[model samples]
Target: MSRNPSPCLVPVSHANGMDLNAQLVLDQKPIRQQQKLRTLTKYIQSYPSGWKKRFELAKLLYQIGQWQQAIDELSYVVRRQPQVIEARLLLGHLWHLTGKEKNAICLYEQTLAWVQDDATRYHITGLIAQCQRRWQTALDSFESAVLKHPDNSVHWLLLGQIQLRLEKPLAAQRSFDRVLSLKPNDVTALIYSYDALLQLHQVKTAEQRLQQAYKNAPSDFRVLLRLASRRCQQHLVLDDERAATLELIRTVLRLAPQSAEAHHLLACCHVFQGERIAGEAVMQRFVEQYPNHPYGWYFYARLLFQLGQVQKAADTIMHCYQKQECDREIYRACCEILPAAGRLKLLQPMLLEMVAAFPMSWSLWVTVGRVWVEKFNNYELGIAHSTRATELAQDQAAAWFAHGRVLMLAEHYAQAIEALEQGYSLGNAGARLQTIAAGWLEECDRHI
Candidate 1:
């Protein structure tokens, strides 16, 4: 379900463990192979005599996400050749994945009987303990795996992932370091390593890791999104990161041809990039594909309004709002998009309908205050709504700001000063809001 790449395991072609070759013994340490010893085992069930082929097939099936089939194949191999430790080890893992926790632990125990290689046994032992949620035992198992096969980057990374999950930051970082030393271009290890570094506030070091990651896998979405989110010391405004992120998302769009979320991210990027039209081109496809999605209506409307296409924008909102399945978010969105007038004629009718449909939402109350104060100039109606906004929000700053602004317009100078002071204290009033309040406060001061 994670469409994004795991910072560790990016999509490897063939879904077979990356580029496995004869060097697996040297590379991954397949030294526990028992081809001759396997043939000597007593067959308790009907299965092929060659345990290695069975192990390979099981691994292949697991790689393809056929956990059940892999379990079946490995179970067959293990039943006949009880001495095939690798087959039993994988069967334990399959059982764990299949939600058979006790069964998985039993397979690991059985595997331990045949596996003399301390490293393989430790690895299986760790995994079984992991299934049991005995994390400390899992640590002991992976630590043993490292002792036996110190050069196995995969084992090192697995250790790091577990350490990270357990919140052992220093230990996790050390494991990632070993993993990186073995496979210098290992992106996943590097990413997790950066995370550990970031948590320690070793930001400059973490940044260097990010740069290293970008150098290694420039097209990877994990790196790009991290960059977009600007995960580090100084928080950059979302607007500042928009241009590069928008372009990065466009590349993702090229890779994933039909992702509404990707399209939505692009639209958000456009909001900051100041390229409303280019962003809209992407949203148009998402809108067409997922018409029922409220965000589809939400985004396209914002873009159209920003593009000065107010009529079209209004029509889009109306289409979503009138539907039976529409969410309350549509009302909030309407409140958000309404302030972008020159679209008021289009906004007004729709807002009236929304107010009628759901009168109690805080958003609708806010909209009513804004509309009466700004558009209708009906000071009395504005005060009524503004009062409600204040009451609903427990007289919070923005509510008070709205209430004060309406009071100034209605010439209730005494109350306006109190409300404005409350708004100013909360740091909620905008410059325009302050200006109006200031003028009224000064008038009251003079009268006093």
Candidate 2:
């Protein structure tokens, strides 16, 4: 009759030494979460959510870009619950969207360290590497990420970009292939593939691919710029094409006025259009705009040389050389426009003096050979000079071209063809030079 001794569902003690439920002691998280959820639900149900709502408060403040308040609430939540990856992720993204890249990167790295998922970690690592100019590292990171998130086309596109920077076209092609497979309408991958194919000299295939890419990515500036670069590489002197190139450059300038390479390329394109004055103006603007840029003085002097401003060009280039001018490219460019005429004899001698002072200068040797051999048409001396130049500048097409011209003039047609063909492969081949070399080759073939 003792009421069957009521079942003991509680612990032996409580706040008042009374029985308490044992379940609460073991499962505290559910109780806290339930309380929080109930409070949140009550505030949400009542429209404005009042002071009981922390998450909605943070969200609302964030929507209005009241970042300080949102940051305070978010920071509080993170402090209260350090395991909330989503909150950290959103804050990191917000920091980046607000242009606080350094802070964003710090937070992202922290979030990535906490994130257990391999795919997400890979993505964050890739982004961080890319932002730091660690391109090879980025490539490796993206490759692993793509393996984890095979369906992520964005990762594939980014991987292709890293490959392109590293100049691994075959690897790049595979990355782009995956991007296209996942998202057939992706413009970036298609355009990049078109450019990579063109570099391989698969002209027909590149043309078809570019046309299709352009159709899909009609308004893409990169596609247009790349196609324009192809036109330049073709080196046509078409008036209409030149105009189009100029227009494309104008459009690019409008979009990105500070792009140094864009300005330089457009200025070079002007030479083909017979707009030398306009070209000079654009190049001058480039110099003014990018005085610290390496190519500015180089292209400026080149334009000046083409316009017959020999002394000024030499003097301008000399100034640049005085300021850490160990750039082989700058030396080569200077040689192209140093004006090796009777009036400029002293300049050539001065350059020869430079060559004497720096015997390792393949460019100076190439210049020496051009003056002694090709331009003066002194066959034995030219051959000797050219042979010396070739010894120093083995892979230079200009040296080969000058040497081949000397050979052709000396009736060494077979040797001339061989040298000229080598020059063509190395990019000293122009329409005028090609016509001459082809004529010499034909003559040699006839004798054979």
Candidate 3:
């Protein structure tokens, strides 16, 4: 009466655990796997207390990329057998993969409460901190992990990635080098080390590392995307080199159709090829597909700006801002596009929001001051923001320049001169600022 011939054949009950695992590993056919899954379900229905069978089922679901189903089984195992730390860890990882970072962190924290092993504790702590973007905490935890287990390449790799995020490129390079020493030609380490090398100004060495990454993992989407992006940077013109870069980007897109970086690179390739319409279309589709992706919207707006659709660009930026995607690039684009399109009034409310969002952004404060003074003639607000900028970054010439500009706009010539002089005194640190300050000083002198 039944179509499935192996309904009663559960590997769990009849076969040894070793044979069950071996069968799961060796059977590559989907139909056979489905049959096994059905048999396992029936076995579990008969014996609801079979945590081992459930865990194995979860693992099999994970292998087949049925993440949600895997998570359900893992959660069931954890709820029933609270001592199963393995199930909890896998469940946390699945939560992270599903973009439930807070849930993952909560689960990891619970595991930390009962976890006794020093290395594992540190590793879990690092994962929690990494999810929260607490770079220093992650760095400390990963540092302890590497210290406790110097031979662990994964530990070194994590430590290096945190160092890179912290902008310690030299230290990151050393950590990545350790990972390479432990596991040579590791594509992840090689790709990540290329970033460190670039930050260290070791451009030639960076290229070599990237080349090695390509050699090690030609099919890896990250490697392919990185290779294409690097080529795009070096070959900006529409020549043979640029065409080759385009081909590389096409390959990356083929491999990873949903990759944001690949889509952006393809758009850039179109721009380089002088196909502005094609570039615009690509970015438009990208933003449509990934509306929550800030960079995609940012680039789409930028393309709109380049295409002479100033009003449309401003509208795009405003929409992005309203969506609460307060990325620095979006702010920069807003600053550029808004004033050019006479939409500074629209930027005013967003400026206050940006200040609250990024209170420590000295450049943003400078822009805030400039906008208030230039657009609204509100020198009081301008000077307040400019003063805050200078207070936040006392050594930054741009901040001092912004302060001077606001003061001059307020007709406080003497105070403006003093601030400009301070900015000019910073020399090479503010070389361009010095020229602007000198001109403003001459203007102030004439007024005084």
| Top-TM-score structure, candidate number | 3
| Alpha carbon lDDT of each predicted model | 0.64, 0.62, 0.76
Please say which candidate is ahead in lDDT: 1 or 3: 3
Error of 2 at 100 (Å): 8.5
Q: Which candidate number would show the highest lDDT if scored against the true structure?
A: 3
Which is the winner by TM-score between candidate 1 and candidate 3?
A: 3
Segments of candidate 1 deviating more than 4 angstroms? 1-54, 144-149, 219-228, 231-243, 250-448
Model 2, position 41, has a per-residue lDDT of 54
lDDT string for model 1 (142-260, tens) is: 99899899998878988998876654556788999999998887777888898877654466787799889888777665566555545211323255654556566666566444444
TM-score of each: 0.45, 0.50, 0.67
Task: Go through the candidates in order and give the C-alpha RMSD of each one to the true structure.
Answer: 14.5, 19.3, 10.7
Query: Which lDDT tens digits does candidate 2 get at residues 1-448?
Result: 2111111112222222222121111112334544655665567568542332665556545544455666666666666666677677657655544445676688778777678889878888887776565766778899999999899998888888887665455567778888889877666678888866653445677677788777775445565566666667687437667677777666655544555455766877877678888878897887675565455676677667777887777766765555443355566555555544233553455555555554554445655555555445556765665666667555556556667766666667788778878877876334555676667667767765
Weakest ten-residue segment in model 1 by summed lDDT: 20-29
Candidate 1: clashing pairs of residues: 7-188, 8-188
**Which model is ahead, 2 or 3, in terms of lDDT?**
3
Evaluated at residue 126, the lDDT of candidate 2 is: 81
**Best first by lDDT, ranked:** 3, 1, 2
The whole-model C-alpha lDDT of candidate 3 against the native structure comes to: 0.76
Q: In candidate 3, what are the lDDT values of residues 1-448, reduced to their tens digit?
A: 3121111111111111111110111224557778888988889899988899999899778655577789899999988887788888889877766557888999999898778878878988999987776767898999998888889998899899888765466678999999999988777799889998876556788889999987766666677777888877776547767767777777766655655566777877787788888988898897777666555667777778877899999988888767654666688789789988998778878788877766656667878887788778898888888888888767656567778888898888999999988876754233344666788999999999
